[model samples]
Target: MTSSTDRVAIVTGGSGGIGRVSVERLARDGLAVVVHYAGNKDRADETVASVVDAGGRAIAVGGDVADEHRMGAVFDAAEQEFGGVDVLVHTAGIMPLSPIAQLDLDTFDRVQRTNVRGTFVVDQLAAKRMRAGGAIVNFSTSVTRLQIPGYGAYAASKGAVEALTLILARELRGRDITVNAVSPGPTATPLFFEGKTPEQIDGIAGANPMGRLGTPEDIAEMVSFLAGPARWVNGQVLYVNGGAA
Candidate 1:
């Protein structure tokens, strides 16, 4: 069995806001980290630097999450670097909003490709290769339940993610590996603020009972818990939205 301090984690989208925080949090917990970025090596390097500077082990790897061969190389890197993979924090996804009526089929396909297909690609690799005591924390959205307008395509992709998480948990039965998804609501990431106005942001922040946006650190705490101490928390979608849903 890998010691807690020697466990390894691969955090996809680790160049982005929430992913970067999750990587640092996991590294702080003593797990060596592989920071997976799609195309942003600079940001990914920054993420890796944070961990390395803190005296933790980390490396940056870039490739499309939906590319099996490419992402497989990412897993290979982790195994080569840290002995084996124990935790997979899959936070790689994209969001582009448009009402169903005005939806571009091309955009919808792209969303499905990146969000849904990308998850399947990485999860498939993790399912087969991750150590027995490992965990897989895939990202979903509260919009699946919130059913907000203009989120049709994005929500659909995540909906598939939730479904996949449930079944994967069962399929990994007796493997000691846990599979789950984190459903965040209106987080204050650049992804969330992409096409909205100040009024819109304020409106969203006010909609939640907490009356504030969720920080990346807020979500990273949950990721840390799931990737480490959340052994029994399998096949669940933890909605970390500050009581918004």
Candidate 2:
């Protein structure tokens, strides 16, 4: 197992929601964290400040996840600031729900670009640069299995992520690095609550066997395990839903 001080991580979308909590968790675990944000510099700065206040090292970087050059700079910043990157938690994604029949072509393309293309760009960079013992964790959704209506476009994007997660793990065979995806079900994040009503939210929570919404920390704990000592658990998509699927 790698000691926390020797580990460095770049957490995309680390400025908010699940990403923010993951940053804090990893920092507390002693990893120097690079918090990547697409916009919202203030939130990113806040996250970094929180990490530092807790006596952990952290820096905030900004970039579009789909832009290869820009994301390359994100990796560059991590290496320049904290030696080399050891873990990457790709938590940046967009979910614009629409039925296939009514889904705007523009919206569909945008989602694909951010969710699918973005994962490809970052994963490619991580695969090339991460050290032998590194780990790459991509975010996916349980909706792909739930097959809920109005989630066709969103699910399709994440479906691509799941495919990449599996194929990339196999591609990295001889390397000690592990690649996996975390599929969370109905987490209590702003993204999940954006267009949802209280009744709708309650319905989703009740659908899970645990009868509650998953928390960002719940997902982060699993990520911490994968990013650190879970060496044998590769090429798998661990669904973090409460037995929802």
Model 1, 1-245: lDDT tens digits are 46779899999999888999999999999999999999899999998998999999999999999999999999999999989999999999999999999999999999999999999999999999999899999999999999999999999999999999999999999999999999998898999999899999999999999999999999999999989888889999999999986
Candidate 1 least-lDDT 10 residues: 1-10
> What shift in Å separates residue 179 of candidate 1 from its native position after superposition?
0.3
Local lDDT at 210 for model 2: 98
lDDT of each: 0.94, 0.96
Top of the candidates by lDDT = 2
TM-score list, all predictions: 0.99, 0.99
* Cα error, candidate 2, residue 39 (Å): 0.7
The residue pairs in collision within model 1 are none
